[model samples]
Target: MTADPVVETLDALELVDHHCHGAVTADLDRPGFESLITEGAAWPGVSPFDSPVGLAVRRHCAPVLDLPRHAPADVYLARRAELGWAEVNRRFLTAAGTGVFCVDTGYAPDRVTTPSELAGAAGAAAYEVVRLESVAEAVAAGGVEADAYAEAFRTAAWEAVRRPGVVGVKSVAAYRTGFDLDPARPRAEEVTDAARRWLARGGRLDDPVLVRHLLWTAVDLGRPLQLHTGFGDSDIRMHRADPTHLTDWLHLTAGTVPVLLLHCWPYQRQAAYLAAVFERVYLDVGLTLHHVGPARAGAVLAEALEITPFRKLLHSSDAYGVAEFHHLGALAFRHGLAGLLRERLDADELALEDALRIARWTGRENALRVYGLPDGSPDDG
Candidate 1:
């Protein structure tokens, strides 16, 4: 088969991973690595290696560690161990061909690389996307009074977004309260009552009223707002996590700031619908592509772009804990998107120039424009 120019172009284009967490700085044993790859519990009777994402790591990332493609899980792990975490992270992160990383710096159970450290490993530039829930939780943990919670949280969140290198804000409301909550901004009394109850109970910020406040606050911050939608870990109720549930909320916030829907998996079509209709709404199948692997990436990407404007689609890895995801996510995206555009090009559905333009927009340009990041020269990683 002849090589597709679309594939070649995308393979060389450096992606801008719009939403991802930092890679772990510590060396991971098989168990530690396995836990990070799968969303479900790593049951004793089963191994994550049998899953699509695990197999993807071996097939796509093994060679980055100097092992052959489709290397056995144990062999792959051994090779990764031999390389050490720093070297392993460098190899995969560089090999991904990602020029920029907008890393989410919250949710660190293990010691992970900072944005600068992660960017350094990949020879890329990095920016920060503050998590709204983390900011609110910190205000609570800092001992703010119930009556004063609303003002205190607003001030803290504003300060967080104003920090140097902070380009945007994110909310894991899907994981916490889900998107089915009342769309309107919570009233002041309602916020105080919710904060008082939350401060007393004290844990993750899951109160619906408080979550609504976080979402509204993200809009008021005036930077790009990223929302976790569709599939997630075991804690999420998938039905409530759908992006369409935010229709009312999106309507209310139109023209305020860019609303980025991240990791829309089974709901990619639904996300596509919103991106098509809403001027400021954008969507990326970031976590979904890596989980589905390169073999099925084109199919998922196809659904996401079915009605989505080419400019509204962006790339992401949602990679966390392990460095293998950084490489695998880019590989899947390059292969998946290349294949889709190649088919269209062969059918005369689009011009070669147009296909190339879409390739650039989706892989890198779209993210840079959306986040207001400089289009720096591509890193030759």
Candidate 2:
């Protein structure tokens, strides 16, 4: 079949992956690789290799390492090992065809690549997105009095966001307190009490008041704020993760800073509604796409774009640990988005020029505009 001009345009465009994590720098065995491919636990007698994302790695990423399409899982892993970690990373990262990466520097349990390292591997420009909870937790670890906690966190967070190459901030409140909390910014006394009790426990930041404070602080920082919304690891409470719960909060924080809902899945429609209604709201089906793979990616993208304004949608990989996700994500986005736009063109519901423009806006332009990033050259990656 002759590919449409829309497909060809997306195929050649260099994506701006506005949200993602670093890939593991170390070589992995079968067990190690399998664990990173799924959001759930690795069960006895069950293999992630038999799953959708696993199959995608073989289909899309195998050839990047000199293996044929649909190579057996054993064969694919053997080839990846032979190529070594650096070479594997380079191959997949370069194959992903990303022009820029906005990396979340927190959440490194392994020796993963840094933003600069990831950018260098792909020949792309990279910037940082500071994690808000990590900063607040670090402040607690350093020990501050209850009355002083709010100021201390704001100070530390300011320093973190002011660091070079930081383009935005992120909050994992979905995993911590969820979006059901009071939308009003917590008062100073409320913050002090919450911090006092939280410091006594000395653990991860799951306190609802503290979480609310962290979010409000992001607004104060005045950088784009990325929130992990839906379909995450086992830690996520799916019901609370729905982006619709954020409606009241969105209303309270209107026009302050961009609120980017990341990895929205089942709630893509709800997210679309928010994006349509809120001026500062945006969303991306990032981590969701690569996991569902190319076959189902269109359906997911279709739902996400149902009520979403074209300019309000953005592209991301949210690829962590595995470089295959980096490549698989870009591939799925290009294929799925191109297909959707092409269909609209065929139905005369969209003019060819409008389809092409939407393709550019969603794939690269929207992210650059939202994050205030400069447009990257075609030679960037």
Q: What is the TM-score of each candidate against the true structure?
A: 0.97, 0.97
| Candidate 1 lDDT over residue span 155-203, tens digit each | 9989998899998999999999789989999899999999989999999
Q: Which residue pairs in model 1 clash with each other? A: none
lDDT of 2 by residue, 1-381 (tens): 876789889988999999999999999999899989999967998888888888888888888988999999999999989999999999999999999999999899889999999999999999999999999999998889999999999999999999999999999999997899899999999999999999998999999999999999999999999999999998999999998898898999997999999999889999999999999899999988988999889899999999898989999999999998989999999989988887788789989999999999999998988888886332111
Per-model C-alpha lDDT, please? 0.91, 0.92
Provide backbone clash counts, one per model: 0, 0
Poorest stretch of ten by lDDT in candidate 1: 372-381
